[model samples]
Target: MKKNLIKPIVAAALFGIATQSALAADRGTPREARELFDQAVKFMEANTPEKAFAAFNDRKGRFVRKDMYVFVIDDKGVYHASGAAPEALVGLTVLNTTDAAGNPLFRQMIDSTRSAPEATVRYMWLNRVTNKVEPKVTYVHKVGDYVLGVGYSAPRASADDARGMLTRAVDLVKKDGAAKAAASFNDRQGAFVKDDLYVFMVNMDSGKFEAMGMNPALSDTDARGLHDAEGHALVAEMIDKLKSAEDATVEYVWRNPVTNRVEKKRSYVHRVGNSLVGVGHYIE
Candidate 1:
């Protein structure tokens, strides 16, 4: 099942297609989803839709692993095959199909085929294995007129993700130079900011802000004496860390802008010349 169909019961009645009703099982991992997608793509590349469909729908086939399975749709939203879903759904048009979150999952998937070679989209869907509505991260790759997709349950954000974003920002700074990188990072709609993850920088020697991903107004301000809710001197700590170590992590109680709640946060700061550049993620 590709999460939730817009009208499961109506489709079943009209087309005799029952795609979402299945036995509950363990959750699928992202790695398994990627592997299944690769295999299905290989099958498609071999110009064997019939064989690919067979492998996708076969209950005992390699493609049907745990809660992960393959599904294919043409650019027109016509289903060719649905692994782990009702076989009768093969020829039906899923143009109006939406996820549990009311997102036009299939329509967006098909439309994306025209714009990019591959793209990933997220929507709320019924996890047939868990029998619960959970967020799914689907990877879609366009092959000819068809879009091959496989998705896994999305995981929660973590500190490692925050560090990776900042590391990439540091690279951009080195490549694009500080002024250009600062402009990019300051853009809230830019790549440096996603979810609760964002990049910030300060002059380690002087504690003056060079850039702040979510708060551009704070840039160029002296924040050396800033402290968290628990009175942990955050900016001062970053300067000290950069003085002794190449890179370091600082933990303190800070407000999560999304939840508007004070929570524990861990920030990973890396020394980029005279600037202490970093990003932080809230933790439970």
Candidate 2:
């Protein structure tokens, strides 16, 4: 009986993991955001605004799950309902509100929806629960006099994509020197940053950040003592590994920008002159 039960239990566990992986992938795509927006629109059409607003504003509503949430705004960019925003945002005009990157995301959303039935926009936003800035891709659709939107945390770049970015960065550093390469890394819209994967450099001697493609604020700071979620001194480990060779790889638990959860990350580091250029990809 034990042996028979073990086989079925193992199969069930594998099935559960497969199903969850599919759901996770679905929730992180633009199609999912559009679908959730459509659901919010249907709710408003079926019920009165008061009833729909109550449902949409619910923190745990069907329209708001995972990292996606539905927000409703009037034609003039006044808030009608927000699934996970603070209560102070309701009934307020937010046309000028900007994302963490100073991009007028609300303004862009309004501009796109005013002319089209639906629009897709990308911006950087702060995850309120995690207090971390992350990239977001939002889908907005105009319904009657309201614009309904659902935004998903952007997906992480694949390991192959991240490896390619690192290769490019390494080649650039070899040809252009560290100063010129730092300029490229500073370009947030440049090739160094591809989706969720970005390049980071640290001066081996000074132990200071020379450049960070993801967050410019992290540049020019001492980061040698940086630790992972489990108190592992990740930067020190990288530096130690690079002391004997030109390249090294390290793995640790890190907060994933897409999921805002501590997950395993594998990083590739290359010693380029006095600086160490590296890139990492989260492992799901």
Candidate 3:
């Protein structure tokens, strides 16, 4: 009886693991998602709003078709172009509207874009049609006196994509059974680690890793949470560190209070005007 029970339990466990692996394989990676986003950005930048709007509305735009609505907002938060009839939304205002979940989406977009001019702001919105809240990623830029906003939407994944990427990375490390694999993975993804710690560095401008080979699980904190706390500060630090040194590296770590882990991380800061920019742990 014990042997029979163990067989079935083991089979079930294997089946579950196989299913999870298959699902992860099918889903898009963070890098893939970012590349797709870059393609959309390139499309918009290369074309006028009218042209981009039409392309996004067209059925051939697979990115728009697979994800959420595509739309643009001006600096003041007015809809300039929409996947829907652009003419209808040309001058409509969204600054006052709450997202499906009642959050002030417009204000958040403005603030984020203003703070990180080159970075995109990702948020969640309730899709009234699906009655589900999905993730929305928007890249905003100043075009003349108005801000050009281009966005793509997708159902939010269970684990934030950044955390998922980190987890996948850890899995890769475990699978390879080598420390070098961690550094290799980070290098491939443009991330870096400081020595043997979990703290990692990622370049904000190029969105790559500056230091490679670090532990990923030390902090017990998700990327989004870290971003909330020290994303801006980290960016500033990177910029300041870049002034005197063209090829400079900095070491850092993050303490995860919940897990009581101290992550080892590294950073290579770069100068961005009077500010410092580069990537490292999301913490300050």
Candidate 4:
């Protein structure tokens, strides 16, 4: 090969390598997003406002990690810094801005911060790596006159994933007991709760909730009273199907906790002694 040709070839190879690296760069987890948020919080608490905002606004700074980035907004709902797109978002009033799902996210942040020092909000946002809108869960903290946030996109679970979770949950119940398994199922941050998929159990005798992974507050409640968006008696249907069969699959319109929308969902239920254990997945 000629010397000039060799130089251009090497340059093109380096460019290709760089592009691949960019594509392979981001795919952050919820744990990493929370860690980055905590680090940014400490940085803000230790440094002056001017220094802290500058660090947050720096896309090349430590505040920006993988797909997670620090974003700050004043109490008035004006953007102070946005590491993701500072040029387009900073210095703008985004209180009225909504997600693709029509969720009033900015106003929700302000309202949430008003009553509590910190909270988590979910909304649909475009994932740069996937070039698609997915479920985004953000951790926001109220500090002085500003609210700082960091978010990461979480993927939805498939029907097979739900079945797998249900199998593990049933195994846990068999290995340990219903009481122990119920405790694990009710744990929101535990293995039972994954993105939009969670395990729930019902007392077949009394028709009461034994465990509700996505919403523990529903535990001990009357499962029979639970109805879907279209007023379908989903739990009653499940119980009726379980009377003659070992397993039951019921479909209904339920609100997805992650997406906060009414979508078609199907739950797989099975008998574990007196309790019925189940896991559900959204159809679309």
Top-TM-score candidate index: 4
Q: Write the per-residue lDDT of candidate 1 for residues 1-284, one digit (tens) a residue.
A: 55576466545432222234445355566667777788778888786777777777786787777777788888788888776554556787888878776889989887776788888877777666555565677889888778989887653357678877988988987888777888888899888877567889888777888898768999999879888888889989889978989899899887765434587988998988888888898875
Which candidate would rank higher by lDDT, 1 or 3?
1
Residue lDDT tens for model 2, 123-220: 88754333346667787877778877878766566678778889999999999999889989979888787656789999999888889887878888
Q: lDDT: which is higher, 1 or 2?
A: 1
In candidate 4, position 136 carries an lDDT of 82
Please, what is the whole-model Cα lDDT of each candidate in the order they appear? Answer: 0.77, 0.76, 0.46, 0.84
Residue-wise C-alpha lDDT for candidate 3, range 102-186, written one tens digit per residue: 7777777766667565566656653323434555556665544445554544443222333444454444444653344435544
> Could you tell me the lDDT of residue 282 within candidate 2?
85
Better of 1 and 4 by TM-score: 4
Q: Clash pairs of candidate 1? A: 25-129
**Between the candidate structures 3 and 4, which one is better when assessed by TM-score?**
4
Model 1 global lDDT (CA atoms, 0 to 1): 0.77
Candidate with the greatest lDDT versus the true structure: 4
RMSD of every prediction? 14.5, 15.8, 16.6, 9.6
* lDDT measured at residue 164 in model 1 versus the true structure, 0 to 100: 79
Clashing pairs in 4: none
Clashes of each: 1, 0, 18, 0
